[model samples]
Target: MQGIIHLWSLDATEPHELTTETLGQAQILGCGSVLHLLRTLSWVRTKQNRIAESSTKLWLVSRNAVGLERMQAQSPDSSRQDSSTRDSLAIAQAPLWGLGKVIALEHAELWGGMIDNPEVADVLVEIGAAIVSGEKEDQVAYRDGQRYVARLVKSDPLAFDGTSLSTENSYLITGGLGTLGLKVARWMIDQGVRYLVLTGRGVPSIEAQRRLDQLEEAGATIMVANADVSDGARMTRLFQEIEEKMPSLRGVIHAAGVLDKEILTKQDWGRFRRAIAAKVEGSWHLHTLTRAMPLDFFVCFSSTASLLGGLRLGSDAAAFMDTLAHLRHFMGLPGSSIDWTMWADDGMSLPSQEDGKFEDNDWGGSDKLAEYTMAPGIGLRILGTLMRKADTAADAVQVVVLPKDLSYLQGFYGDRIPPPLLSELYRSESVQPSGSSDFMEELEKIPVEKKRDHLATHIQSQLNRVLGFAPSQTMDLQKGFFDLGMDSLMAVEIKNRLQTSLGCKLPTTLAFKYSTPSLLIDYIATQILALESPEGIVTESKRAANEPEEILNKVKRLSEEDLEALIDEKVRF
Candidate 1:
């Protein structure tokens, strides 16, 4: 009855049969309590790591409702109190759905997913089949009697109808003094939000104070509260004070969250818990405190980590935001969670030169801003549209914008890149070539000595194309591919291209093995010549025919006068 009862290790040398007792308990528990779910997860992971089996493995957890009327209809004997409890339970279980995504990434070979479905039977069958079939996707949703898989798609700019906020209503923005929060406060003031309550845990920096003053000058009342949102009693008192002092709290933007530099492997429970507390616990407190109040909208600012699971330890924050969105929907509240990408301005923007915390060439520095970053103006417009459309949108959760080019992200995600993003990434004009053709005919027309130069140029051009380098930019022939920012995915892509164009079956490690344009050119030229010989044979010896190492060794053994003479002859040629 406790501590992983009836659990069969997945790592067993022989497949273990499910017992009647285990099946009975599984049916009775259904998805089980959160603690039971976590225990199951731990066991499955241990098995997956130990066995390394190819058979499909899955973990299914469901909580979100399909339809309020449909759920009520199906359970006619259930009372209103029962429905309310179920709704709350659904919200509590939402975080696990997010954690499921992390698990899928960590154990991609297992065909894992965390699903949110109303029909438990259908989810179980689908997940079981997926595990057996080795399905690739990780996140799934079952709503309105239909199964939906997550995909990334290009987000068009929101068409603004000039929607404006009321002057009488006050908007509470947690983390208001932070870079993103300050931008939201300014946008709200510009959009006719007359009263603003900006909450953070610290006093404003000198620059932040000046901005607050500017907002006041623009005919807005700004109140800065130094309070921690995770503290329930403190938040309760703060809300009570706001209710008494300001106009009714018409909206709440739960944007307060901390981002740590550590990855999941390096993060202990304390660090992980703190990373999520502001967004997870803080949002929960804000929701409970404001549940009774009639509000226009409650927006949770989330990140793409929940969907993609590559933001180091940011997955914890994503899980809570995802849960909060579900909780709001279950309660029939007007709420939306917007999963955002990196912004060019204000929010998660590159640190300024004055800050001096990061060097210019750092990953989060200005150089990266030019590639696939969203402008703050565009991001704010989209936010406003999402807030306005939250009530009418089909799903309570949405992703506002994604990087137009995913080359940078592809390095980290590889083929596991979400299906939704694949269409957009492939559709981009830069990633696709205008045409393709076999270059065998062209290579045959060239003379032997010049063949190496031709192939080298071809390789360089292809490298430039895949890496998004401009036509005018040139690479050093001797540099390593990784030093040129070529990741594993990109290396594979280049290898595939060479194989197709040259009409030869190249090894998957071609790019990594040769590592430089000059070296790859020599290897290809040698192989082609050997294949074109009278014997018509191709082998490793053919590829190493140039023997640059032997030539270098001979040069090292020669006298200085003889080496200079040989170099002069080669240079002349």
Candidate 2:
């Protein structure tokens, strides 16, 4: 009744009641189902906490390849549920490693690891022996014999061959009404794709319709389908309709997805479900329906968030795409998950400026690093290149297109960046400031009173570069940042510049707190003077050492009335 159940032997007997003793005795608890895996993992975590000395191994064996590396490296076009569900499940599984690590650290006798084996029963004994003997070195083990490792290798720029695409072949593009989708559609037409089926949940916007009309006028047939990709039945029917009308469904660009900005803690199940439906469920539906069809390419439009996990960003959505990539590899499908960085014109790249132009939000506002924003043309070209390479590169499941310039990322990642990436980053020429270190030193050496004006000028110059403003564009010193056309993105860039140049740990809200250029300049000067001044009343160095203790002792000795008067004087300063 306490023995482990083989996945294939689910119907062999009635469900056995598992006790803590039984669970502890069992070296490996294998679960084929993700649900069962999660349940077992939770139970193990509880048991580990409850019984400090318990050693248990939870083996999560799946027929499909599932891991961070597999998910990150491969592009897969599985059922939409597979992508979203698997991704959510994968993320949910991440805590198991943490639990295992903690258990290992706290109790040397405790051992646990996740193993991915298609035939769980075949390796159950071997895995169990390994677990019992404490032979496994890593927390996660793969039974498939394939290793997933990321290597930074320079990909040669691909030439755009217009002759490759055929007019008789039709291509399906989900989210075609959106800016990026529309751009891709237009680019496809230019590349000799005469028939294009663009699908979205609603009617195209007036602007999108106008663009579609222009494409139609250019002699390309554009069919806009008002259908949701998450609806499997609707997708099936839509594909049937396309098969009937179109000459041939040659390719598909799965670009449909919803952007949910809520952080994981703030996000509800509904929000996560809705955000993932378009990318995960939709892609799954497309893959299921189009598996029989002979297609040249099937591209999943994924974001770099899949790897980076941006602040309050789409972690769930990224995981779905990563899982989709792994699923595609498992299925031996012809597709690549392009983990793309930010694009300047479309998507959630940057907020639009007052003149309707998009500002660069790359490098998180640091000019010291290389900008990572890709133009629409450049993005399209990369996509084209990836599609062409997909045929020859069977092992290449994931294609990450990063900015050639990566010096800026060093500021954020520092030594944590992988050596492979570092090698590639140093291989290319990085952007350097025109201003010399000697010039900056000379500016810093100016009289404290004069330093404020010099710092303001320097700050203004840096702001102008980021905002794409000319040297002659005079900024109002009294105006707030918002009034001066400075947004959150711009504010961040300004803060980064100040932190880097002045060597001060400025607050993220520095721009908003100061409000104006003159105020910010004054604040910076005060901080710089406090840092540099040796004879100042309350220098940072003194404050760090014994100022707090001294202040507390002085406060304790003062009377109520005297304390109030002392606080007033301190506030005045």
Model 1 regions lying over 4 Å from their true place: 1-60, 65-89, 106-111, 116-132, 141-148, 151-157, 346-363, 390-399, 404-409, 415-573
In the range 37-140, model 1's lDDT, one tens digit per residue, is 54454456445543233244555555452223212222333333335433444443444544445444444434345555536576556565554674554455
Best by TM-score: 1
Against the reference, the lDDT scores of all candidates come to 0.58, 0.54
Native-structure RMSD, model 1? 12.2
TM-score of each: 0.60, 0.54
Per-candidate total of colliding backbone pairs: 4, 12
Worst 10 residues of 2 by lDDT: 350-359
Residue 39 in candidate 2, Cα distance off native in Å: 21
lDDT of 2 by residue, 1-573 (tens): 112223421211111332223221221222113224434543564555442233344343333324444321222432222343233233222222222322222222223333433344545644665557844432233323432223345566566663366788899988887777888889988888899999888888777889999999999998889888878788989988998988889788887776543322233445545655576566667766776777777778876554433422233344455555555555556666777776764423411111112223322233322265677778887788767755446444566667776665543322222222234344323323324455368676886545556666887776666555654456888876655555333455566666666544455445645668778777776654342433453365566689789988988999999989988999999
